[model samples]
Target: MRRRFCRPPRLDLPSLFPEGSGEALPAVHKVASLGTPRRVLALLFPRLPVERLRHPGPLAIWAAQGSRRIVLSLSPEAEAAGLEPGQALADAQAILPDIILVPEDPAADVALLDRLALWALRFTPLVGVVGANGLLLDITGVEHLFGGEAALREAVLDRLARMGLSAVAAVAGHAGTALALVRTGWNGLVPTGEEEAAVAPLPLAALNLEPTLMGVLHGLGLRDIGSVAAQPRPGLVRRFGPALARALDEALGRAARPITPIRPPPDMAAAHDFADPVVTREGIEAALDALLVDLCRALREAGRGARRMLLRAHRVDGDVQEIAIGTGLASRDPKHITRLFHEKLERLEPDCGFERIVLEAPRTDPLTGVQEGLGTTGRTERREELAQLLDRLAQRVPVWRLAPRASHWPERAMARVSAFGTVEVPDGWAPRPRPVRLLRRPPILQVMAQVPDGPPFRLRLGRIWHRVLRAEEAERIEPEWWRDTPDRLPRDYYQVELDSGARLWVCRAGPMGPDARWVLHGHLP
Candidate 1:
């Protein structure tokens, strides 16, 4: 009779191999042909250094154990200088001559892991985070869905490799056993009834015990799991503490260990992997349309709307093209997003064909209220018509040309104006009695005749003669004395109407000081 085996609810072993084959398997052979089958994910944070935390800015840093380079998230200058995660400050300086160091952003890493978890859910839901940089997935029952266990493993490895990820994997009866096997360079499946024996030769460090406990184990000459298991349970518990004893028991299958699987979010992201690369605007648009439609359906069914959408186009040459667009309002309208993308598509040049398109909306807001009578000749229609006109004008003229003037200083107000989109003017801003156009720098002038503290008699501005008709003497203003400025000039300003009916705003520089001069500062439109 064949040996009876019990399978738990979450455990499925038939998916791994064919059933009922009564063949004796080798207990512990380091098979050379298959090589080391440790499944490991090396999260290489390319930027981080000890010195970077001093000044806070856009960049972040992180340090990893056993890593030579300091990981930094700075620009090319920082990376080229040899900064990476976990590099010593002095060592980093020697390695990278002039790179700046920054503190690591744990928040960003957590967010990245969240995204990775979402992506990994497509393969298996039994994913768990291993430290800050690695993830563990229990591909038991799910492996068969991809084919046999070997084929599924190969597929996973191949997919990750194609996505430019360096990962290693191992399959075993338990997670701890699998982790130990993978870390110790044992990548294949450990035979039945041999989980304990398989992990026995590995180091105590593989059990993920605390460093203090590991040091104690080392001092006690308990270097490997086999040595630790040889000790009496009560003595082990009393000497090394309960944690180490528990870890040992769990490794030996004397205690049960359970793993909590990572769950995917309610909303789903849809993507497509192309058999061949597509390198045209039309191709990108087509791919985007398909992804948008699928994602929209998912959002609709979930009663959600996306406020921000991110499109990632994977190129054939391994570069990821990311395009992010934020809507003015929360919208579940697929056509609106598609149209916006269509408008953006004209500006993009796909040098090489894309292999995949990933549409992700990690941020979503509830649909507020339905917009009724959208196509009618009301406020919405007027706004749309105005928008179309603005777009046409933007195409002909620069966007900045249509922007409004921004200023707080009444005298120097309206000096520079940007395009409409670039400037965000606040609502309910009442215009002051200031000139519509103000000069950036007031021009110095020579006065023919003038009263000491009154409006000018006759002003000669750049060889042009102007007669003052009605003079309006505005208040005299002084510069902020505390602020050091060698070029700061005291001024007596006058808003005068010219004899020709034009208005000119002028100022007399150095009103009470030496080297005083008259200047035509600005004009009132």
Candidate 2:
């Protein structure tokens, strides 16, 4: 059987965000932002898996199921030849013996869909991937930029045509409404408040129910969405389950679905559009500087500083180039931030010149005003100098700082933290005294102690013996019970001054016994 008669429901749109409350809604249909409905543009690639390869032929992609090979997707030509997906390879060959069959690559198809979704960001930053062959763009406030909804749809469709991909697209007040319309081969704009009238005549296949549920509905002579929605909802939910009712409600705009964007919209961003494409390096830099000035003013007004900023260069040829920079300290200085991107500006490939430049601060930190010290060489000045040095060094290499972690275990005592952030150590929390040179893995040593449970009097290195002139009181160090294995043993560490005047820190594992091991942990300076 072919998918020509089947409409795959909006099954993968995660119903994560619920209405009114924070509690998760049951997995029925994905809904979000209960009040004013937003416009969603659903783009469906009818033959993505085959088109991605760009192989010119009557191609039918197949996958092996046990001993049987079946058609999974077909190229435009194969579909025109009456070859459909789900048909057995042997049967398909009988119809067209010269058909070119390629194995299905679902992973490649998914990756291409993700890339296409990113490319769709040129329309709106809020683009979402639907299943393996579709994309949903939340073009709510973005329609006016490309003239209107109809013009925006044509711009998108025309762009795809140039890219050599066949796509069917629809715009509706609800994502589910848009998705259902496109899957059922219905194209055009379904204006807000008129979703029911537009979706009613579509086939029940647009509801995208389970195959068995579809068969049951077909047996009951309910072929179109209007007939199914006309029946009492309680009776349908009781017999066929809630999925059918939910799908119908979503398509009719009674419910709303949110598009989880591929990239979360930036916290703050500024964009500049040029009347003509900017091809020269100086022109690109000027555009970037203009964007940064606006972006920095916004940051200063919000009392915030950007820790990481991203620059997206939208080329005239429908390609996006991105350049990102991270700071050692959150900053809003336009000139300083511009200097950071000086070395990276050469990396921007101005393919056919860039028509638009967008600068976004994906991450920001609170930068409230603070009182400065009276002296000229104040703490603020010192901090600014330090930040400048770190930022400069970070441009050439990765830079970070060490912060203390609250753990008794030596290995867990420290953590690597962002250099831009402050490390807050709790008051009265003192770190354990550690030797100057501590070994990650302590070396084994043979030791003779005056008492079975006392400190060592003599110790043997690889080929030499050192007599202990004096030994400090043993310090018992226990393993962190919550973190260490149950069978792990405690150690008694001792600082010893040897006959040769060399000081060594040694530890004995567990209680004094034949199995007790002596290890040189570090050299005490």
Candidate 3:
């Protein structure tokens, strides 16, 4: 079954005001500035020569001549002259002797409009994107809050001008009339029934048509909106297709248009603008406390807790100082967040007075209650204390100053491991039953020794002669023959206990060969 939904009544504010005041009302002056003009230049001129340089493109240079900077369409003359919509100054200059500049970044313009739309949310949520650089907001029931439509428009315009943006706005019966009127530099509002009369005089280009389509209409002698509106609907559709017909209907208030708004994330963010810039630590802490309270309230309302908080201090000198802290668990408790900030506050140096402070909770989750009976003097607390102690020891001592010894391989039985705090110790691992005094790297020994497959009776290491009192052969480990290099001859490893209660890890290179040699690798510690 086909279903029908009733259309909501259009928001009308004209009835409440006097006859001349409502429709003939003067538009408030507002401005919307695109901060990143280079981005705009890039979007307009992809092949412009100015992009070849390492620095910023010459937007100001191109915009110097108003006529050269204005373009009617993307023409072959435009392309041949190195004039794309968003070309760089150097590239444009190289191709065309006379060209005007139009900055490129569509994204930045879109962003600015989006921000304006967000601020407009305070007035009305029914706002929609209009073309690439404009926004349409339906301020129906919201006019009363600002005292009237004229007052509301004034407030919006004042806020925009303060932010350094220029905008043309009109309140009319239809979107088409409003757009046409704004382009004609008409500031006053248009009456409900007068939309058709007001829009008829404006050029067909005001319908937001592509350059080609507008050119074709101009060629056909249909120069304005009234000419297009007067044509038969079927004939217009047959000649220009459904797009033109639909656009006509939309402009004449026969069709309804809706808008979507960009909303902030559910996580809370609060900002404080100071009456005067403050550079002291105390001033920053005070601002942080206020923001924290606001953020906590927001999180509580959403039934969530923050796990991480970021504090940003914007100084008057254009420097932005940021500090971040994480709580291992989720918590919306203002005291806890304030305590974390207190610890980090000591590290920040507020060089110049800060004009604004912003607090953001980027990560949050539902909170779970703490467990009971977890005493302050528990094993977990002791472990944490021990870890801290070890961390301190590692920072103070060099990595080469410590060793771990075990009775296993010849050179590896007593490995020389780093003493850094980052090293992981394996669980359930036990040390060998050997003497604690071990050498860092086994010194090479000259042996007037005996036995080919047995322990040596006499040897000299580091100018000290030692005789074997008791020797227990641990076992022989041969190097894999396929993996042996030219310098690495196969050797048999051995663990020998010396006469002075010291155990040594030793290896014989070129094992039992004609060129046999004795070399010590390490000692058991």
Candidate topping TM-score = 2
The C-alpha TM-scores of every prediction are 0.50, 0.83, 0.42
Question: Residue by residue across 87-147, what tens digits does model 2's lDDT show?
Answer: 9999889998988988989889998898788678666667888888889987765565466
User: Which parts of model 3 are misplaced by more than 4 Å?
Assistant: 1-149, 159-165, 171-181, 184-202, 219-221, 226-234, 249-284, 306-330, 338-525
* lDDT of model 2, residue 389: 79
Looking at model 2, residue 344 earns an lDDT score of 90
- List the candidate 2 regions with Cα displacement exceeding 4 Å: 1-37, 272-286, 314-321, 342-356, 370-377, 392-398, 405-407, 420-428, 436-438, 462-471, 479-487, 497-503
What lDDT would each prediction earn against the true structure?
Answer: 0.56, 0.78, 0.55
- Global fold similarity of model 1 (TM-score): 0.50
Ranking by lDDT: 2, 1, 3
Report model 3's TM-score to 2 decimal places: 0.42
lDDT of 1 by residue, 1-525 (tens): 111111112222111111122343221111112232222121222221222233433333534545444443454445455455345655666766555555466776666665555455444434667665556665554443355556666665666566545456666656666666665555565654677888889998678888887887798788999988888878878876788877776666566455544532223355555666777777777788777776776566557687667666656544556666655345566677776566656655467776666666756767534444454657856654554454445444554342334333354333344332345555654465555666777787665445457676666666787777778765576765565386786667778887778787777766633466766667887
Question: Worst lDDT window (10 residues) for model 1?
Answer: 1-10
